[model samples]
Target: MIPSLIRMARSRTYAEAINLLNTCQSNAATIEAIRKSGGRMNDYAIVEMNDYLRRIGYVPDDLNKLNVVHITGTKGKGSTSAFTERLLRTHMTGRIADVGLYTSPHLCAVRERIRINGEPLSEEDFARYFFEVWERLEGNTKTIYPHTPQFPIYFRLLTLLAFHTFISLGVSATVLEVGIGGTYDSTNIVPKPVITGITSLGLDHVAVLGNTIQDIARNKGGIYKAGVPALSVKQDQEEATRVLAECAEEARTSSYEVVPMIPETALGLRGAHQRINASLAVALARGFLRAQGKEGMDDALPRSFVAPLAGTKWPGRCQRVEQGKTTWLLDGAHTTESLTSCGEWAWGEGNKPGVLIFNCSGGRAGQMLLTALLEAGARTSSSELVELGKRFEAVIFCTNVTYTDGHFSSDLTSHAIDPNDLSQLATQNQLRDAWLELVPGYDPKQAHVVASIQHAVDLVRGMEGEHEVLVAGSLHLVGGVMEVASLQGSLGMV
Candidate 1:
């Protein structure tokens, strides 16, 4: 494997890196493993990830040296991670040299998942590090981790590459967001993040996770390492709070503090829920700074933290993008709770007529998300005005398949959808039906479906007059539309 790395290092261009990646990527195998087990989180993912890391000459301890700020939750993980990274960079840029950010589900490019100093790795650097890790594992999969997978799955590989890049670049601080629920998550292989945090937890990923909020909280709390400062947002329910405390004790961390959400906190991101996320970010930043042995890193958020927290900009989360004929209120809120907030944020403040551009990944929660959005917009009583439902005249559901050719961008190609869903338009149709039920008298003609993102953009482009289009439900959908609509290269929307 070492020899393979040396050989690939000779001339592994970006194209070859992508080819190797496509050949190696496989979610079907994991899905099959889950199906065989009747669908539960098992040792398979944990063993594969840790074994693969060991093959590439990395261990959990090595990752700990990167000074990680690990985070997980049902929502706001990315925004909290973003704020943590930006805030750390504010004080640690010159001190730390480089701050590595490892996140998941990139908007457009896989490079977006592995970043340093606020920018995604360059094509040349990404390909270099990508193949360096790939070939090393490829060479050893047959022998070193003989019983384990020869190549790590997509996210696992990126996780390895992120650690490699950060270490190789001499990074002093790292921000890590869990790819899934924390207990068996690929990123959880890191044993000792300097500070671990759980943002808001909710009933998301219920099939793999358990059926209840307490179940989800325990799973997310798995990132806590003993003797580390474990922080979390204050849970709304007593059971959730109890489960979090139990998990904290189970993990036996040095201390646990549930940071309270500040009321009316100014945040760069839209949506009211961001105030809590911002508060968590503030706590994480303080913990990270204190870990560096920096003086004045006391309990309070430094006066400097406010500007970055309030001014932080995380792309595509409740962002507003205007192009040509429409104003896009873009958010990647897929869960019921977040989507409810998105609906209120979209309709509660504005009076202009809206057109909803919505799609969720194939999940059981699709109907629930749609219901939450509609309820958010609907009036609870006769005297109360109906403001939410009246904002949108059109609701479009489209597959996140980016191109008219029915192919996705290289980075996005790994999002597995059942072939039947693609052929039958199963999920999109499900959303359309749900929309009809929510708005009883609205014309079925208002609910539309398109083949690809290009078709969806064209449908919006053909609309008459000014319209506020709420692009919600999936980040992939928003990113696909942005790529097709030529909004990616625009100014000041981030």
Candidate 2:
């Protein structure tokens, strides 16, 4: 029954499979089946996804048979991946050069994670690939050790699915993004990558990754395979230089050669930080070309790659939109450092009076971010900073920007107060008063909490104002803002 369901799901029948599961009676065997065969975090190790190539009877006879550029970092991984894919497609012609890109935390659709030449995988493709992988794992439940349905994790399944999809599709080159820390990431199964790229390191996911910069760097740098070329765009030159040096030394001694592929100038993305990202991409591309013995094959490589870097556009990173007299700028700067940098870049060296629509999840350093934004000259004396007290503005307008699980949606809005501020607003009246006071001019008749992010964007669009609508909060909000603006035909204006 489980095998059939898996097959059905793989054949673009996900809805049926899900419905069947819900209606089926709970049984130890059924649960065991899901536990054993379903996706798991460490399943990559148990399943040994790399071995599938032989089992499926497809073998690459040469080292140059497949080109892989592995990119991992704290930020800019998505943009770098997109830029690299676009550049390669534009330059590498006539070979049906398919570029496989896998990014994390989709903006609106899960299909957005996997792309071929800048286009996302379609819904049918996702369903088809998902079930195909599941079918392959069917009847081999015993092969999985200490199997637990919840243990292997969904992300592991996605990783294997991506690899299988890329290979089956005969992608010439695949750009894989490390889901988390690189060394143990499932994508690490790829053998002899053309280049390994790293983006700027920051303090994030502290509980899982590490508490300090070096600790995080060590984990991220784990993806640097021995003997493979590498590139990085770390801003703290000394820290980046030191970390890369250490990684290089370790890799060299272990038979892996590491090379510096920093960019010489800024690419298309905004902020000085992006210049580093472009550099990393450039370094990786150069190494890839050299490894393929295509170094001098095209004189356009240098110019073509560099030219696109400057004009390369990525949504939610200081994206701007104008509606009538009002200008909307969306940025997903959740951390203090990122917020400070973004505010500085947006407002420039001088202070500007602006309206800031801000909100944050529980664990983020919101207070610190607020302080940084204020110091960076973001707040106007008249601008209101409405912390989501008890009754936050009910309708949260989301622009198809990036978001996280910790972000507030209708499900968690009631409990979405800042963890640090939860103690202060214990009383109902206090919370209500705080919420009401935050909105500046509260009109309950016009107030309603919205479920969809697009609704909030529409509301903003209908408003009439010359003031810049600075959307500074989470990536989810930024995405929502962009999607709404795009719908209104104002996206490219940014």
What TM-score does candidate 1 reach?
A: 0.90
Question: After TM-score superposition, what is the CA distance of residue 275 in candidate 2 from its true location, in Å?
Answer: 0.8
| lDDT (Cα atoms) of all candidates against the true structure | 0.76, 0.55
lDDT of 2 by residue, 248-314 (tens): 6676523232334443655656665565566666666666666657655344237657666665665
- Model 1 C-alpha lDDT per residue in residues 1-494, reported as the tens digit of each score: 35554554557887657655665565644654543332235667777777787778777688878888999988889989888888888787564347888887777777778888778888899998987787677567553445565676666778888888998888989999997778888888788888999998765555533457766777788888899888999876678788888888988899999986654546777777888888888888888887788767664567777777777777777777777678878788888888878766776555243788788867456778888766765632221223445446788889888888888876667536667788899889988887777666767887898768788888888888888788888888888877787776531212
Indicate which candidate wins on TM-score. 1
Residue 428 miss distance in model 2 (angstroms): 15
Q: For candidate 2, what is the TM-score?
A: 0.70
Alpha-carbon RMSD, each predicted model: 3.5, 7.9
List clash counts for every candidate, in order: 2, 30
Can you give the lDDT of residue 344 in candidate 2? 65
